[model samples]
Target: MSASASEGPVECGGDEFKTDKNLRTSLSGLPSKIVAGSGFHGFKLNVKNTGDRAYQRVDFGVFAAQVDEEDYFIDTSHLTLQYKDPASGTWKAISLDETDEGAGYLGYTDVKAHESFSIDLRLAVDKSAPAGLGYAISIGMYADDEGNCVFSGDGSYYEFDILKAGTAPGDPGNAKPQGGKKPLPQHQPAGNTKIEPQGHLAQTGSSSALPAIALAGGAAVALGAGAVFVVRRRRNADSGTAA
Candidate 1:
């Protein structure tokens, strides 16, 4: 979406327009903590239209304020905002218009009925940003460039922290072994013995000599039985001849 520079200052009918219940907005993918002076962090803002009619010339803006003190606006001059262009699939800078209501407005086109759209946003917190908690960003949506209508419910706020330089959560140096215990040693093979591969016959504990021995035993038994049978037959024949 492109900014409407030619259009004069946007008047969002501050506090006069009722909150539109048909629209819903949400913010996600924001990191809970960020390092000051780091590169830009990416997040997403989504808007859904539950109403039957399409919203034309819709606009949304970003503003930051300290928690518990909404009236005291934080200086976001060091912050840079960029939105990904859906058509080109490339990131483009969004023009921030300083409004009288202390919010920076970015122009958007329309939200069709029963349709939802998402904007991928990248925010850079410069090194000048104070490292602490209680920092929050609010998004506001307005209908029509003339600002006749404002969508109150179609906005949300998210809170995050700015960390000091070279500091991050869950540092490895700060980690301690659990329950004061040492890790178990890894398994290793014993001593410098070389392992040789065995053949399939050796694996089964069988050898060629085993089958040969069995066959020789069987043949010897058969030969002894045949000799006894032949001797008995000759003895019967000789007895018959003598009779």
Candidate 2:
């Protein structure tokens, strides 16, 4: 999947792409080629407080959206978080379950007035994942002071593709196969008619088979008649020879 293909539709009108004044955040450096066995710590989420009010307990979240069904190959399992130690001031890997707010988010990253908070982010794609698939990544931020940060303040959506392993970028994407083809019109029984699996055409009604069986029986009767006539001819020939 190409990066453009993974990026969903963008609406041009009416605050569709505007950022919220109070909380503005962006996720950057997502890999175009995601590999399952590798860890990427270079990706980052930066949340900045743009509003005048300084809020406490300000929390930020990294939420993922799998836009297409193919997203099953990649998930939050491929993402991890790290925090800078307040004492050592060194980034240390942390468990999402330890930091998650129980509302399905990554961390409770806090930001202060006119300041920004950034975290070390990582992503890994499963080695077994198919050649093409992706997930739409977004940063979800909320705080005690406001609902969300966007003027539209919804979510910032970004795209990443699990490019086909052997193919270069811009290659034609393999189409996702469509499903739910109406099962071959099952043989429906009307009244007492029964459908039997006599052979490959079992689903077809049995009436059509009757003519073939009748013709076979007629051939058997004709063969018997021929045998009887041949016996009488042999008996006459033997009598003529004896005379």
Candidate 3:
């Protein structure tokens, strides 16, 4: 086999997934399907280190991109992250925006040479989500081995499109394969929406001590209502003073 046919990139590496076929198939069981109202196990981001350098930490995040921006949206408060503990072989919460003070990223996971780290994502589509409603997952990888040497641009954060309820995990058409970035029109967003990434920005609290901006349910309502309240108060004062 030619060197070209071997594998990808020579340095810090990445993959769509490293899961076994049987396991992938089994993950499609009734229990693992992307159902509404609950956060169940979803896909995993597998990062492999083929390079000789050891990364003190491998930072990554699974952000949402909308393929079907219908009536419902993902309840991000319900979205969470988990990393597999190599020691006990268990999944632990690395809850992104729920970190100390308010919002931040868990950049403590490390990847050593020839080793790999798996970040498990737990997600839920909103209730009453349309059947065709879909969203893609985008990933960002950065390696700061205490020395802050190199990084991977990003991979397939926009390739996935998971259908809403009634779709079984075992179904072939249930979800798009994990990572595959395609060309999407500039004006026509294939899976881009208001939802933003939930990771630490430059190792600071989401935005340098500022609260994370949330546009989830009722945000717009609050803004409009506040305007109405101010207008009404001014009108009342004017009416009282009028002769």
Q: All models: lDDT?
A: 0.42, 0.35, 0.32
Ten-residue region with minimum lDDT total, candidate 3? 184-193
Q: How much does candidate 2 score in TM-score?
A: 0.45
**Candidate 1 structure quality by residue, lDDT tens digits, 11-114:** 32223553566766655676667677888878766667777866433445443322212223334456566766555567766433232321233334445567
Model 3 TM-score?
0.41
How many clashes show up in model 1?
Answer: 0
Clashing pairs in 3: 56-145, 66-191, 137-157, 138-157
* TM-score against native, each model: 0.54, 0.45, 0.41
Tens digit of per-residue lDDT, candidate 2, span 120-172:
55555544545443433333322122222222143334445554344455543
Worst 10 residues of 1 by lDDT: 209-218
- Give per-residue lDDT, candidate 3, residue 242: 26
Error of 3 at 135 (Å): 3.4
- Kindly indicate the candidate among 2 and 3 with the higher TM-score: 2
Ranking by TM-score: 1, 2, 3
List of clashing residue pairs for candidate 2: 19-151, 20-149, 20-150, 20-151, 36-125, 36-126, 150-153
Alpha-carbon runs more than 4 Å astray in model 3: 1-39, 69-106, 138-150, 158-170, 173-243
Query: Best-fitting candidate, measured by lDDT?
Result: 1
Query: Candidate 3 lDDT, tens digit per residue, 1-243?
Result: 000111211122232312111111101111223554445545655555555554333333333322223323332343344545444456555432411221212233334445544545445555555443233332322322222113243223222234455655454333443332222110100111111122312222222222121111112212222233334445767799521
